[model samples]
Target: MTFDPTPPHEPRRPPPRSALGPRQLVGAILVLLPVVLLLGGLSRCSFAPGGPEIDPSAGPAVDAPALLRDAARLAPFAVRIPAVPPGWRSNAVDRATVAGGPGTAVRAGYVTGAGRYLELVQSDAPEEALVRDVAGTVPPPTGVVDVGGTRWVVYGGDEALWVADVAGVRLLVTGSAGEDEFRTLAEATLAGETLPAGTPPPR
Candidate 1:
């Protein structure tokens, strides 16, 4: 047998080494990370905290005339006593009768004052009815105040006068419109006419 052996096959050349080493991979990642972060920051800057940009001033403008009309609608009905000062406006008068009474009592009034708006409500419900109604609706009086020697119970939002020891007269000065505006309206209304003694309160 001819035992001539062909030269051993040359060792297979090792696969070509990768050009990227671990350090090169890390460097490439570090370079790209800042670019990614910059893009993210720019995207965030274009929008608000949660989402789309919103123009703060883009809202409905207030309509003063419309507000005044609404206020007129909510205003209590009242007769503008002839004594109401010039420039004062009043709504039509309405009457409410007490559950039981001798003669019908009249109730009417308007807003007054400068700083805070005051709702002036006047009613002739007879002292008993006035006190009863007030007690029914509001907290008890803080204390009684004597005006002109007449004992008048003063609730937070109302006042009562005892007429003929049985009949009631009430002047409700409400801080309802709130303290600031109430002061303005109160002063204005108070400046107007005093309610007639027998004006009936509306039911």
Candidate 2:
């Protein structure tokens, strides 16, 4: 037998390290960098300080009597002796009265930084007592201006009292109604009264 001398075979080369090119690497970095930054920003925002921390009991205690006195001072006409109810806080006062005449009134008084009054009335008086009352609670009317196309007596106080007519419902008690509520009550009152055309509803 003839023994053939043969050279040893060479080993196969390994595959290329990766198919990613420089452009692909740059594109990936550009896309992923923004994602990483976004994640970091979201994490920082979640852990950031100075976020809203509310304590249900942290605010100043409400004083109803004090609110009533402030309301009296702010009201245009004298505040009839207010009969504050028990547990009333001096920082907030609301009163209601039904006179036997052509008027029914609802009043809300509050002192947030300063005094604020909101009143509703149905009467033929030149100025609605409720409007006067709220204006009185405010600093004082600088001048009359139109709000939402309706003319109102404006004032400067911590907050201003707003009055508008509500369209139905005969008697409404104060404290039970809000600013919009009083407006609704005033509108209702006007509809019931059926005043002459172009006559402004009682404030």
Candidate 3:
């Protein structure tokens, strides 16, 4: 009998070769990463640390009522919360004391009935300062819009502004809303003006 050098037992197939090609090998690595991580305990995986991104289409949903209630205390006058106009919703109300100055600013942010955004800012801050804060631009007042018994001065831009002086306070409606919409808000605000109802007088 001839003795064969080759073992009759099947030789190991070099640990079965991978059927995946080069590209597939890369993909397989990606697919197995999660499994490897899961098995190894994922606590060591590096990830971006921060809050989730906001979805712009969802729109900003701020708490306007709470803002108004809080601002009513710090505002110079009774914070006259205007009735929300049709299709328009107030998103936020806020008041801030002017840094390094003796003034306070009260702002109300709204998404107009048309879904455009604007903000109403009432402040005793100097005209230059307040205008800068609300509108970010103090273009020469181009014209005046008379809404109800009040007059709103208009500024031109892709953005719009309707401003007026009422009872020694500078009232500004400014933002991305159109000029007509801005005026409509001013009219509604003026018509519905009143201090927060049932607010106890300051001691």
Candidate 4:
């Protein structure tokens, strides 16, 4: 038999895999990822709209009296602490500097018995500046509502505003409160009732 001059052909060997080096892995990923993404996109899926399920207006219940006392300690002059009617809740209190004065400004947010929301900004800032801050762009007062001896300028908008100066501080009351609820808050703030001057716990 004539010996074949060509040696037995060795089986073609695959390029050594190099134990899946970074380049091979990256190339494999580049090739397969698009297919995986296309498949995932074609699959029908549904989800609730993105946002917290909790109500935005909801906040932890706070002690109105305690908050007022704390705020009073922070404020140089007495800050009005309304005897919020039954079922009323105080949600938050903030201490700030009076815009143009040396005293402290206290802002308290309240939920009325009828579930109306409002905020009382007791700042020593100029009444004009404070009103502008509360009402954004101010129009000539649509009218004025008098609560006891204090007269509050009524401003109408998406959010209503009733502004006055009481207890030597320019007070601004505004929010989702109705006319009646707004009047109630104004009366409470201007009614001369104040938080006790109890010292705030050492902090």
Candidate 5:
């Protein structure tokens, strides 16, 4: 028998299918990860209109009286802790230097019985300067509201500011609380007494 020069013909095979390599697979996963996370986040968001409704009374209660006592000792001006009515809660208190000037600013925030927020800022700063700092800018007084015969100059519309000079310091009442709640806080603050002098705890 004659020996064949060429080997027997083999069956032709198709070329291998293209696929993502290790580096390409990692790159694709990286690109897809942010999109997946963003979609997940969007799915969890509320689509309802209007701003978020906050529960002002939800936070931890603070010892406003004790805080005010400490602030009174350190502050140049007297600090009076408001006798917040029943169901109202004090949420925060802070004592800091007046912005852009010398003097102390003692702030105590409260959540009213109706779940509205109000902040009282008693400062030794000048009326104009303190109001400017607290109000962010001195908008013209919208009007005036009387709290226990004390006249409080009003500023802004919806977000109101009721400011008055009581005893020896300026008291600013501002927040989401309604005019009535604002009046309540203002009245309470005005009615309250200044903390007694002597050795006091750190502010």
Candidate 6:
């Protein structure tokens, strides 16, 4: 066989490949940005922190009975202190002036057994004026409920306000407690004995 002297053919070179196109790189970064940020945020968040724990149910300790007695001795209208169920606590007691009127209001606030807060106001002021005093705005009565032979005027929607005229005074109950708790307070107020301001003994 005659020897062929032609040089060997050079190997074919494939087209140069880019690591990533600008558009592909941008799309990949956009998709991964959110995941990176989410992971970073999760790393910073702690399930349990080394700090003092707060008790949501705990409230200020107040002597409601003594406050009521003092109010009864000074208030022009009658006062009644309800015997709330166990685990309930009174957090506030103070006198408030009737709005746009000529009367005083005695208020008592309680944190219920379920950690709900509510208030009772006793005043000689008319319903409208007293409501304006307690609530920033005076809302029209939505309905009336007969609880324990007494009529309680209901106002507002879920955040309800109840008013009743009993024992020569207008009693208003407003709070975050449920309707059942409201009824319980109303019944207790009705059942409680009327305590009128007593004359001071000779000094």
Best by TM-score: 5
| TM-score (all chains, Cα) for each model | 0.33, 0.24, 0.62, 0.61, 0.71, 0.69
List clash counts for every candidate, in order.
Answer: 34, 23, 1, 0, 0, 0
Give lDDT tens digits, candidate 2, residues 49-72.
Answer: 322222323444555434434444
Question: Ranking under TM-score, best-scoring first?
Answer: 5, 6, 3, 4, 1, 2
lDDT of 4 by residue, 1-203 (tens): 78866669867667778766898888999999999998897784533242112233466677766677777776666577776677677888888765533555578888776556788887767766666665666656788887888888877776777778765667888877667878887877776466544456336
Please write out the lDDT profile of model 5 over residues 1-203, one tens digit for every residue: 99977668966665453754788778888999999999999997764332233465588898898878877777776678788788888988998887876667899988877677789999878877887788777888888888899989998844678888876678999888677888899989988867643337553
- The candidate with the higher lDDT, 3 or 5, is 5
Give lDDT for model 4.
0.71
lDDT at 82, model 6:
83
Q: Which runs in model 3 stand beyond 4 Å of their true positions?
A: 1-57, 62-66, 99-101, 196-203
- lDDT string, candidate 1, 102-169, tens digits: 32333333332221122344455455555455345545556564433444455553432222221233
Give candidate 3's TM-score.
0.62
Q: For model 3, give the 10-residue run with minimal summed lDDT.
A: 48-57
- Which residue pairs overlap in candidate 5's backbone? none
Instruction: Tell me model 2's lDDT, rounded to 2 decimals.
Output: 0.38
lDDT of 3: 0.69
lDDT of each: 0.41, 0.38, 0.69, 0.71, 0.80, 0.80
lDDT of 6 by residue, 11-70 (tens): 666655475678887999999999999999999765433222223367477888777777
Question: Residue 41 lDDT in model 2?
Answer: 84
